[model samples]
Target: MEEFFNELFDYNFFCNKQLIEACSDLKEVPKESMRLFSHILNAHQIWNARINGLESEFGAWDEHPLKTWEEIHYENQRNTFEIITNTDDYETRIDYQNIEGRLFTNTIQDMLFHIINHSTHHRAQILADFRANGLEPVSLDYVFYKR
Candidate 1:
């Protein structure tokens, strides 16, 4: 299971790097693209914080400046790898509060997978926004990363 999760983290990092690079190339990134990617990075940080029993350094919708994105992203991925390597109980339930301050509990494994699924969902939306803006979308599909 750890092996599976390590692969997912690797894939997420790879795809995120690709998307960020493409976004950086734009003379002006679309507002929605910026918002979505910011949300993606913020959410990843929040999840890792939740698992580690710490306060999130970012909010769900916070807009991190594009200039600081890759650096922030690297920190998030590094923390995620640390979490992945150190976690001993994936099935243990984690208690956390949502951005709305609603309390809930979910298994660590569920949260791990949710992070990947959540990022992929938003990344798709960002791609759609890029296409709508007449920009080329970077290929981020998992199979493409596997090769």
Candidate 2:
């Protein structure tokens, strides 16, 4: 389970890095793309904080500057890797509150999967926004990354 999650995180990291690199080359990122990507980074950090039992330094929809995206992404990845490495049981239930102040419990593995899946969901939105704004979107399919 740990190995599986590590692989997923690695893939997640790659996809985000690719997107960040793609955006860095642009003169100006589309507003929606920036909003979606910022949410991606913020949500990842928030999930990491929840798993680590620490207060999240970011909100789910917070907009970070373009220059800070890579740094926050790296920190989020590092924290997740540490959590994955140190976790003894992937099925261990975590109690956490959502952004809406609602309490919920989820297993470590489930939460980890959610983080990756959530990022993919928003990244697709950003890609679509890129295209709608006359910008080329980078290919971020998992198969492409694997190949």
Candidate 3:
């Protein structure tokens, strides 16, 4: 299970880095893309903090400058890897409050997978925004990343 989650996270990291590089090279990244990508980074950090029983410094919709994306992303990836490494049971339940202050409980496995799924969901939105803004979207399919 650890191996599987680690591979998924590695793939997630790759796709995010690709998107960051693509946006960084643009003369001006689209407004919506910037907002969506920043949300992506923020959400990942928030999830990691939740799993570690720590307070998150970012809000759900907080916008970060492009220059800070990579640093935040690296930290998120490192923290997730640490979580996966230290976890003895993927099925261990975690109780956390949402940004809405609502209490919820989920297994470590579910939360880890949610991070990847949530990022993919938002990345697709950002890619669509890129296309609408006349910018070419990079391919981020998992199959392509594996090859």
The candidate maximizing lDDT is: 3
Tell me the whole-model lDDT of each prediction, alpha carbons only: 0.94, 0.93, 0.96
RMSD of each: 0.7, 0.7, 0.5
Clashing residue pairs in all predictions, respectively, total 0, 0, 0
lDDT of 1 at 125: 97
Per-model TM against the reference: 0.98, 0.98, 0.99
Tell me the lDDT of candidate 3. Answer: 0.96
On TM-score, the stronger of 1 and 3 is 3
lDDT of 2 by residue, 1-147 (tens): 988998999999999999999999999999899999999999999988898899999888999889999999999999999999999998999999999999999998888999999999999999999999998889998899899
Residue-wise C-alpha lDDT for candidate 1, range 1-147, written one tens digit per residue:
889999999999999999889988889999999999999999999999999999999989999999999998999999989988998999989999999999999999999999999999999999999999999899988789988
**Model 2: how large is the Cα RMSD against the reference?**
0.7
**TM-score of candidate 2 relative to the true fold:** 0.98
Winning candidate number (TM-score): 3
Per-residue lDDT tens digits for candidate 3, residues 47-89, read: 9999999999999999999999999999999999999999999
Candidate 1's C-alpha lDDT? 0.94
Runs off by more than 4 Å, candidate 2: none
